[model samples]
Target: MEQGIIVTIDCETRTTREINLALREASLAQTPVRLSNPDCRHNLAVGVTTPLSVEIDGHVGYYCGGLCDGVDIRVAGDAGWGLAENLMGGRIAITGAAGSAAGATMRGGTVIVGGDAGARCGIAMKGGTLIVGGSVGVLSAFMMQKGVLIICGDAGEALGDSLYEGKIYVRGMIASLGSDAVISDLTDEDAAMLEAALGDAGIDARPEEFQKIVSGKKLYNFSTKEKEIWKTAL
Candidate 1:
């Protein structure tokens, strides 16, 4: 499979280290890479800071695009746990589902999942936008500090538990809200942002149909009277 100036790597024949080295070299050259037979390998393309575009033909295991900056990674299949973990910048798109903690502790960039995501989808996410075209499991945004999470399908129990400064938008049923998570009225500005975000993800949805979830601000300060809330969150 050859394209004009596109480098292709056969993951079936090369070791992970060799593949990554080749990726780094290609990135340095500012070339696009296409990987075939990824075979659910772990730790592929980790810590790459270059602004390269990568196309993976098959499923990828843990940390497929972790700790990257300014790269655009597209996985044609599913992704395992810790997908794009600690990502500083860039975009990671999974055509299929993603495992737990898909964007854990990521400070910036965008992550788009075309299918459902497992538990803790955006756990401890500090910044960035996570768009899930399908449902997300329990504790989806557990302890999220910043960023935006948009779920186009149903959300499981304890959605956005103990979050701070982050925003959540849900277009489907929410089983339950997590401690310190409360519903907030959507504003015109929010609608515009949602529209743009959904457009970027190529998801067709009306922003007005979604509901916003934000921190109740009760957990920001410890109060003796709010012990019950703290007990549940802590």
Candidate 2:
């Protein structure tokens, strides 16, 4: 186990194959691992079975940690598409920007992005907490189910198309709402829930300032006649 101000060193020389090798040899259980290189393109530390604190100093490619649990992960830079594709559970902190579909179809965990997120940020997210600081592009949460989509900045058009059984919150202006989602009037229960989730995600915005996006029930599955009717209409 390397110990000191610099405990671990993985220069992102190769794909994640080399990076994970460093992670495996680092003895992270014995020390705090820090990947200092910023230019590393490797998909480092994709699936960490061991519990450790890993901090990457720069942007990373897709599926940084597709599925991980019982670890504290922090990214000091931006992330590519599908940052945490199918996170089971853990705490992920992003200090920089994030790309499209940051947490696509994730089941559990918490994702915090301090900067803007690209389009389709959390499409089909089943469970988990996604917090985006800046704005997002069109179709941010299309078909989102069971989870929370927190947008501290504005949201683009057609948010949560055909969504079902999920909640979305935005602080800035909204461009449009999809067929399966809308800004429902908040009840006391909803306000409380939003406030609690935002608090857990380290977001300090008030519930009143936050706009909640609720999904529509139409897109859950296919209907018999209306399915064809809608298809013809389109």
Candidate 3:
């Protein structure tokens, strides 16, 4: 492994503005950073484009690690809304629960949530992999264009609502299925894919336990007949 420089920031003692400046500086240098006392600040570590490792020791607010690419961020505690939103590349591991829209619109990357996530998890995701060890809330994966969403626990109502080209796997009970979203066959290839995703997230769950969800193809080509279903995407 390559040894990198370590930059530590004590959030409790420093202003959030100062902390963000230090974080940006370290990111520019491609150095590993340790952040303590996150204090629920929003937009921490957004837009990083370097290969860096960041360890956050406490809970964070909205948009943590958003728009990140080529970086790895690990949060030791719960995260607020939109964690890793619009991420392009890299990995974000959350050891605790996450708020709404976790991994929303992510194009590429891996986001692992160790606990339950709030509503709209993985919404509008164009590409990437999202693995949640616990449950997710309503409208999860709404309008997802492409990607993989794996839920090890129960999924809230309207799971995968209006899903377009994404693959959703839920291991537990689904309260309801979303419009244009239906249960699909879990093939051997899908099992292998789920296995790999679980392994990558360090989750010890059987792939066979999952149920797959995919677009119903009813709205794929979009005709007047599909108008009713298209409302679900909005």
Candidate topping lDDT: 1
- TM-score-based ranking, best first? 1, 3, 2
Residues 26-92 of candidate 1: C-alpha lDDT, one tens digit per residue: 8888889999999999999988998888999999999999999998999999999999999899999
Cα RMSDs, all models = 3.8, 3.8, 3.9
lDDT of 3: 0.91
Q: Which residue pairs clash within candidate 1?
A: none
Query: Which parts of model 2 are misplaced by more than 4 Å?
Result: 1-6, 12-15, 24-31, 221-234
lDDT of each: 0.93, 0.78, 0.91
Candidate 1 residue 6 Cα shift, in angstroms, is 0.8
Worst 10 residues of 1 by lDDT: 1-10
Better of 1 and 3 by TM-score: 1
Which lDDT tens digits does candidate 3 get at residues 113-198? 99999999999999999999999999999999999999999999999888899899999999999999999999999999998889
lDDT of 2 by residue, 1-234 (tens): 333544556564545576676665553454557876747364666676566567888877677766766446788888887777777777788888888888888788888888999999899899988889889888988878789888999998898887887789899999988887867877798788878877876767888888777965766678888789998999
Model 3 lDDT, residue 112, Cα: 96
For candidate 1, the per-residue lDDT at 165 reads 83
